[model samples]
Target: MRKKWITTSLIAMFVLTFFAPLEARALADESGKVTFTKGLDMEGVKISVYHQSAPLAKENVKSLCFLDSYFLETGYCVTTGFEVGYNGSENSRFVSLTENYHLPIDLPATGYIWLETTTEDIFVEYTVSDYLYTRDVVYMDVFVPGQSVTVFGIGMSDASSLQLGEKIIDGKNIISRSSNQITFKVPSDAKPGGRVFQLVNPISNAIPVYVSPVVFNDPYQPSQWYLAQQQIYEAYDVFAGESEMVVAVVDDGIYLNHEDLSSKIWLNEDEIQGNGLDDDKNGFVDDIFGWNFLHGNKDLEVKGAHGTMVAGIIAAEKNNEKGIAGIADNVKLMPLIVCDTMGCDAASVANAIKYAVDNGADVINVSLGTSGVTAYSEVYNEVIKYANDHNVPVVAAAGNGDVNGGIGFDLGQFKQSPVCNETKSSDVIGVGALAWLVSLPAWANYGSCVDVYALGEHVVSTTVPIYDLEGGLYTAADGSSFSAPIATGVISLIKSAYPNISNAALHKYLTASSIEGILIAEDAFMLIKEQYTSADDFVAGEVSAVDVDIQAIFSDVPGDHKNVQAIIYLQQNGVINGYPDGTFKPENYVNRAELLKILVGGKGIFPDAAMYNNCFPDVKNDWYAPYVCYAKKEGWVGGYPDGTFKPDKTINKVEALKMLLNSQSVQLPGFVDVAPFEDVATTDWFASYAAKAKELGILEETGYFLNPGEEMKRASISENLYRLLTL
Candidate 1:
């Protein structure tokens, strides 16, 4: 009876299993839900459940384990086992099963799992996988997968040699190698999950690898506060300055061999080095790079740290993998040493000015100044005048003397000798120091003489090795000395971007486009704004509209004349004037008296009324008597051999050019040839002057003849004079 019962039960089980296939097929047809759970704080983990090998719904899961141990493989999910039997042939018996898992963590560990299901429910197979501890991992805030990253060890004992999962890192994986760091280009198959790197050289430990989205490799760019303040980087995005522009540093000797400055130093390719002869024959002998006026020699060996610092501020090479960037990175630094330990002499400064102007320097920086040397002093004044006449802008320090009467002594009530005077304002930019970009430094000289304000206090730049206390081949300095160079650098950048810009236009752009409201002084603030704003515009080749109205200022000037605008400009600026009848007398010849007044008045310099005691005896109470006396005193005019003033004498063309050029105390280069002029002879007294005028573009010939002996009409005078001022 028991055997009969067992047989009956087995037959019933076999009949039940055979008929259960229909119920399983109904179960497989019904859609099922999949739930996923992960350790605490384990975001981006995904699990999917599929039916018949079709993609199903995916669920993001988090773990319930402690956050600290989330990276470790903790068993947080309950597991159950179930069995299902196959009733068909061996190959077609089993149902297809696949578990798709994904984790968002960078360099996540992956493993396989097994699952079983019965007709009633499904079960999950659990397997242990590696974990990444956040504390053990060193990484940047963000990174793109499959990109390169430079990594250095933080707390790991042996970071030099590393292994990613059993794959030993070698030259194939590293893009570059250094003593303490390695740059690796992540493999293309790298997944966005936590990864473990084994440090195996000095000690055994697992280091987590994290990635950042971006990287900044320059070591010192972040510390350049002045560059940031001036928005130099933004300007750099448009233009980094051109290499052809040359900026002359007329300061103490510069460190020519500095790592950051050596490549940017101006080399005189036309002249041979150390030849002990004037190879180029401009003036100084053996000026291979630039002249050293202080020693009267060719050697640019740094005797003081001032020039080096100024040169670096103007142009220390950029993207060279070291040091801070200059405002104009591509500019050439022409070091014109004008000072030594004894300080700069007026003669040396003057010579340096001429050197910079005669050479290829596009900008001249005078970061040195005398405190009490009156602005009218001929010592440095003549050189500055020459620079102005040649269309080369000269930037000078407004003296270091504190005019506010603070921690330092003032430059006296009448400070900033030479540069502070009214005469220099037209061409010389007197710079004052600012602590930040907003406020003036306590020691910086201010007042009407200060043309612009620049970051000078605590300014960091390259200096001589002996003076480099910062150990990085650079040092921090302060004063108007640095501020002047900062302005020079800015001007150099503008000139580089717009090589065709006239000096007057360049000056206008710099003053007109500066930022406003930041500086203590209204003019200084405006200038600052102009410098920062117009630089990018100039680089973009944007032309600013002319704001001054020429036709309205001078009634005597005809609209048809070629220099009507220039004449109006001069008249509006008080440099020239019309006749008493409201007529410019454009067709009349300019008399000696009128010429003297125009030249003397153009500089904005005037002799004291009491000092004009009728030096010229021709006409004591003449209409031009005062001007004639002033001109005589200034050595700009003289009487005839018979001691006659000749106030109404009509000046000839050659005479007019000579007087105008001489008014600026300009010394022309040696006579080359007179071929430009058809009538002028090489042996004529004014031959060199005519040649210089042609070379300077001051005398544009309307015809083949240059009537040197003919009296110049008022129109020709105005046109040529405008060219002289703008050239």
Candidate 2:
């Protein structure tokens, strides 16, 4: 076995010098201080200085709060750590640093920022300053544990400055330093794997805090991902569990008593439910359907939180008026509790996966990994390969380590990396954890080595031990261990939706359908389109290039009932289209170009050839040309400053309706005395839209009228279209 370590002495020298002078600095008095009586001069951007004791101090600090200083100029992500100046100096400003590892010009993944002093007892006082515009580069920490990782694009002053551990499996370079940051070069030899970086501050007893290189868990952005799962569900017709998909979880054991999970648990209908006889007689007595590999008994009893947690993530009853919704509301959970109360070994895990594949399981989710590579690994890998050949998908979690340091917090990296290696299998989808922070979780790992990212940090879920603790019930805990199951559940959904789809093709389809590919806006309906219309028009019939159905989304015709009258009015008005299936996709995202075309076309102002020309690099000549020309001609909409007119972007109900209200034709009376929704505030952007929609009788304030920026559904669009036509 090979061992890798980091040389702390070389980097420790500067860390000692950086904080030694903090004790000599004096307190910040009101004399030279510039305190704003009303409020200090901060630019338009939201600005606030955390006084260190704020509840979110640790989080804000980890996110490199001070990096906002340099970012004001570049609008790029930068982090600034802690810093201080000479005692009682005339000028005072904390420094923030960022090192561009990819290129000197591009944004770097991680770095440090000098925080404004807050504590007087502590010589440092990170005071917040005004935002400004300037161009300045900073340094960062680079951690390399293995020589196989190739170092690249480092702004280091000397190559000899490279630091090596006790064993030279690799060499790490500590590059330049600006303000309070030190930049390091990433070795070019680095492959898609885990690495660790460290930050050493002078604070005593706070051993050099190491950062995991994997700073991000879910590579998918939030705006694009919002309601993505719902969209996926909408794309496919709902298929009940009995239809033909079975999700097998190789974990501790499942609670057959849990309401949400109980009904959906896979049962060998061929055999009796609780008969002590091995009706099928596979091996052990009463081997009803699923077996317990841990206890070596035919009890088939539900005992721990581990199996339940994993099961819940994959297939807890959804909308059944019970527990929290699982990824698939209706999917069979074939529980194979192989791990004991403490944990399990390679042999048991391998056998469990093999059992799932040998049996009727379509998708196998293994939430456990080990440090040892054994002949059983061959069995597991072979089983994974066999599952893949048979069109099954295996999802695993990337080992949690100092992704920043290339070492695990407890066991260190490289000791046992099952996810890193097993991912090589075509059937395996290795997942990494992402902290829930909006951006820059100092601890989340990042690298090409990771495939898809999901919410992993602080993730609360069912724990196996908690089951025994709560008496055969449920409890919640947090870990990447729990996240893998959600992904597994999502896979089960995809499989259930398209039973004949190959595992590889299903993976592609899921990735392609990922909402992360879409761009979201304040208006829920106006999401940006990620697909290129030029490619093949539409990969699927539901959304094609030539035409989109916007009507047929309602049940009760508008003229018949007061509630649905407005809905029909909009459709009659040509404000919306119905699908071939006679359903209106009212709530669906209204593409920007499509909305503009609808509005201009309704106004009878179609654009000509000359007006159809656009200047954006992304737009094409034949695509939405007339709509673009007409919108620009009518002053109804404008292109982004970059000259791009993103047409496929979805328009929210508020923005779409506001544009309608803004039209020269539509006139709405103002309401001085109208009741407001409990959730809608007067300061909301869509307040006027809501008010106007109510007066026009297009929307009823009594029931529901979601404000601006809320996602618009196909049904809502149909109703609005019908109302417009009636008006």
TM-score for each predicted model, relative to the true structure? 0.47, 0.43
lDDT of 2 by residue, 1-727 (tens): 0000111111211010012224434223322222210111111111122222322232233333322223332233334332322222333322222221111111222332233333322112223322221111100112322212222111222222333221112233444443323444444443222222222222111111111122122111111121132233332233333345788887777877676577878876656656667666555565554778777665667655667877876666655544345656457888886776555667666667777766678788776643442112344655665565445677765544433343223222332333443422235665555432212133333343344555553333333434444443334443456656756765675555435344433343343343342211111111102211221121121222112223322543333443354443333222333443344444467777667655653443334434476545655564367666756665766777887877777877677777666653465445324535545566666566667776677653356546556656545554564455445
Question: CA shift at 466, candidate 2, in angstroms?
Answer: 5.2
Cα miss at 547, model 1 (Å)? 3.2
Model 1: per-residue Cα lDDT over 1-727, one tens digit each:
0112111100000000111222222122111211121211112121222333222211212111211113333222222221122323231122211222222111113222222232222222222232221321212212234555554432233356666545566567668754334567665544323344555653223433432221123234433445544544345445544537888888787788888888988888888877777777787777888878878888788878888888888888777776656767568888888777766666777888788877877788888744333233446656766666555788877766533333322333555545653342355676777653245544556666666667665566777867555444766666778877777877776666555344545455455445551222223223333433433232111222334454543465557667786676555333565543346677788899888767765554433333475776675765466567877776776779999888888999999888878876668867656465789878788887788888777775756789888998776766676677665
Give candidate 1's error at residue 383 in angstroms. 0.8
Q: Tell me model 1's lDDT, rounded to 2 decimals.
A: 0.56
Provide the overall lDDT of each model, using Cα atoms, as 2-decimal numbers.
0.56, 0.44
- Cα lDDT for residue 6, candidate 1: 12
Candidate 2 has a TM-score of: 0.43
State model 2's lDDT. 0.44
